[model samples]
Target: MDKLIKGALQFMQEGFNEHKNLFENLKEEQNPHTLFVGCADSRVLPNLITSTLPGELFVVRNIANIIPPYRIKDEYLASTAAIEYALYALKVQNVVICGHSNCGGCKDINQEKAKLLPNVSKWVSQLDEIKQQVDFTLELNHYEGQHGLRSWMIEKANIINSYNNLLTYPNVRQMVEEKKLSIKAWYFLIQTGEIFEYCEENGHFMPLGEKK
Candidate 1:
C-alpha cells in the first residue's frame, strides 16, 4: 500500500509535470483509437507494451482475457458492457485481443483447475467449448515437453478464441461487416520480449517485425 501511494505521489510530481499538456487534454476527454482486451495479469501492461500514452488505448481486462458472446440478461456483465461501450459509444477503430505466454488463466484451462475457485469455475465454464476445440496435438505430456513447443501453441490458440468471441457481439459483427472496425489477435512472449501478430491468410502468428 505504501509503495503504491509513493508511486502515485511520484506520478503526480514527475509524470504530470513532464506531460502537462497531454494530461490537460486527457482531463477533458478521451478519444482512444484502440480497445485493448487483455488478461488482468500484473506482468502484462498494455500501454507499456504498446508504447502508448495516456488516453490512447481504452482497456478491458479479465482472467484469461476471455470475451463472452453478447447476451442481455438481468445480471451485471463486466467485460461485455465494456466492449459494448468501446464499440458502440466510444466508436474505437481497432480492437486488439492480446494473449501472453505462460498465462495462468490458459494454464488453468489446460489443466482444468477451475474447480479450485468456485465462482471463477462457473465463469470460465463459458470457455469450455473452446477448450474442447483445442488440438490435442498441442498438449504437453512430459515436463520437458511442457517448456518447449506446446506452450506457445496454447497461448496462440487462446488469443484466437478470444478474437473469435469478439465477433460474436452483434454490434461488433455489424461494424466489422461494414469495414468500420477491425479485430486483431496478438501473442506477447514475456521471456523473449517478442510479439506475434496473427495472420489471417496464413493462419499463423508471425513476428510483428516480420509482418511490418
Candidate 2:
C-alpha cells in the first residue's frame, strides 16, 4: 500500500512532469498505433517492453490476455468491448497478441489449478478449446520438470489461438484482407528478457531483430 502510494507520488513529480507536453496534448484525445493485447502479469510491462510513449500503444490486458471470440450478447464484456473500441472506434493499425513463457494461466490450464476459482475456471476454459486445435509435439513425460517445456508449448499455442480468434471479427477479417490492418503474435521470454515475433510463413517465433 505504501509502495503504491509512493509510486503514484513519484510519477506525479517525475514521470508526469517529465512528459508534461505529451500528456497535455493527450488531454482531449489519443491516437495510438498498436493495440497490445497482453497478459495481466505484473512482470509484463507493455510500455517498457516496447519503449512506446504514452499514446503510442492502446492496451487490453486480461488474466491470460484472452480475447473472447466476437459475439453480441447482453452480458458485460470488458476485454471484448475494449477490442471493439480499439478497432472500430480508435482504428488502431496494428494488433499484437503477446504471450510469454512461464505463464501461470497456461500452467493452470494444463495442471487443473484454476478449478479452485470458478470464475477463473470459466474464463480459461476458452483456452482449453484453443488447446485442442494445436498439435503439441512434446509429451509431458519427456520434460524433466513437467512445468517447463510442456507449459511453454501451451503458452505459445495460446497466442496463436487468440490470433486466430481475432480474425473471427467481421471488421478485423475485412481489414486484414484489404491490408488495412496488420495483426501479429509475440512471445516474451522472461528469463532472458527477449521478445520473439511469430512468423506466419515460417510457422514459428523468431527473435525480434533476427532477419527472416
Candidate 3:
C-alpha cells in the first residue's frame, strides 16, 4: 500500500504536471471515443497499448474481460451497466473487446479449476459456450499443438463471444445496424505486444496494421 501511495505522489509530481492541460480540460467534461473491455490483468495496459490519453478510452476491466449477456433481473451487473453508460451516455463509436495471451481466467476454464472459487466459477461459467465451440473445432481439425495453443484458441473464442454478446443489447444492435457503432474483437499477445483485430468476412484475427 505504501508503494502505491508513493507511486501516486510521484504521479502528482511528474506525470500529473506533464498532462496538466489534458486533466484540467477533462475536469469539466469527457467524451471518450472507445469502450475498451479488457482483462483485469496487471500487465495489460489498454491506454499504453493504444497510445491513448486520459479522455480517449472508457475502459472496463474484469476477469477475462467477460461481458455477460444483458440481463434485467440480476443481483449485480457491473459490466452491463458500464456498457450501457459507455454506449448511451458517453456515445462511444467503437467497442473493443481485448483478450490477452496466457490469461489465468482462461487457464481456470481449461483446467476446470473454477470450482474452488464459488463466485468466480459462476462468472466464468459464461464461457462454457465458447469452451464447447473450441472443443468441437479442435476435434474436427485434429489440433496437435502445445497446450499453449489450446489456451490461445480459447482466448480468441472468448473475445468473439464477447463481441456477439455486446450486440445482443437492443441499443447496441440498433446502433450497429444503423452504422453508428462497430464492435471489434482483439487478441493481444503479451509477450510480443502485438494486437490482432477480428475480420468478420475472413473469420480470422489479423494484425491490426496489416491490410487485408
Which runs of model 3 end up more than 4 angstroms from their true locations?
109-115, 144-146
lDDT of 2 by residue, 1-212 (tens): 99999999999989899999999999999999999999999889999999999999999999888878889899999998999999988999999999988887775543455556778878888877555433244444454445565677778888888898899887788999899999989999988999999888888999997727
- Model 3 superposed RMSD (Cα): 2.0
Candidate order by decreasing lDDT: 3, 2, 1
Clashes of each: 0, 0, 0
lDDT (tens digit, per residue) of candidate 3 on 1-212:
99999999999999999999999999989899999999999989999999999999999999999988877874678888998899889999999999999998876543455556778777888877787777788778888554777788889988988888898886788888898997888899999999999988878999997726
Superior candidate under lDDT, 1 versus 2: 2
- Please report the TM-score between candidate 3 and the true structure: 0.92
Q: Which prediction has the highest lDDT against the true structure? A: 3
Instruction: Give the clash count for model 1.
Output: 0
Candidate 3 lDDT (Cα, 0 to 1)? 0.87
- The residue pairs that clash in candidate 3, if any, are none
User: Which runs in model 2 stand beyond 4 Å of their true positions?
Assistant: 109-115, 132-146
Model 1 score (lDDT): 0.82
